[model samples]
Target: MNKERNQNFKKKKIDAESSYYYALSHEIRRKIIKIIGDNEFTSFTHLKKELNVSTGTIYHHLETLSDLIEQKQNKKYYLKELGTYAYNSLKDNIETIKAPQNEFKSSFLNKMMMITSKRFIMFHKKDRIYTVLISLGIIILGTIFSILNGFTSFFLFFIEFNS
Candidate 1:
């Protein structure tokens, strides 16, 4: 019985991963997954409005993702365990997918991000204090650089106007 259960679980996981890949293949489905995952529980009307799609269109996509999302009480939709797995996977990989392929550094950055994140996670598995600190530091530095760039651009514009 235990062996049977393990086989069942493995089968379910494989089936779920296939469904997830199919569901995420469409742009609308990906958008729907993101919104549903974000809101915890989303209504059909809310999804239609946010996605700017017709009721029929929403329903079509929902049907396509039927294996992933589950309808709840009060006309709300949420991800089941399998759906949650798919959503988490999508969230983890979305950055790589969303990065513009037209840019040369996007691939390099994505690879670097993956490598650094894996190392960071492994090293800080016990505690995330260092991770938080590093993230905060990056945000601060990015903000400072943005402000300086803005000021520099404005200064250059002023100089150009006076000449």
Candidate 2:
């Protein structure tokens, strides 16, 4: 019986730890942790206002974050011990966490704009001018072709009608 009880306690502990990590995985819950950690304590209304989310969203995240945060008799939410640790870790590593995302965004924009690489046709001023001239030349050629084709078709129809 003692062995069984020990096993059950270990299982519960593991489950709780998993739930704690699960709560931390969500962006909204992480924001909640940061907000409460920053203020030391905050009311539900304050969290709602700060997060700019619906009441239901706040409730759902608060429920999920139950293990990390708790409300006092004063009716404000405060971080529990684990929550404080999470807050500190997140605060410390925020730059490291965001660095890759920022880098990806900048690199993606640079690739899309083609402002950095000279291999693309529109990088230099001369290349841009050449591209514009080529584009206009194509448009003019296409317009002229269409006009000639239309006149030929009209002349054919006129001759066939008279015949």
TM-scores for the candidates? 0.53, 0.56
Q: List the residue pairs that clash in candidate 2.
A: none
Instruction: Name every residue pair that clashes in candidate 1.
Output: none
Question: lDDT at 122 for candidate 2?
Answer: 42
> Number of clashing residue pairs in every model?
0, 0
CA lDDT, every prediction?
Answer: 0.80, 0.82
* Residue-by-residue lDDT tens digits, candidate 2, 89-150: 88978988887777646767767655433434545776787666666886677667756655
Per-residue accuracy of model 1 over 1-163 as CA lDDT, tens digit each: 9999999999998987788888989999989988989888899888988999888999999998999898977779998877787788889886777766644477786677654866566665554787777778976776677566553234234222221
Off by over 4 Å in 2: 98-163
What TM-score does structure 2 among the candidates reach? 0.56
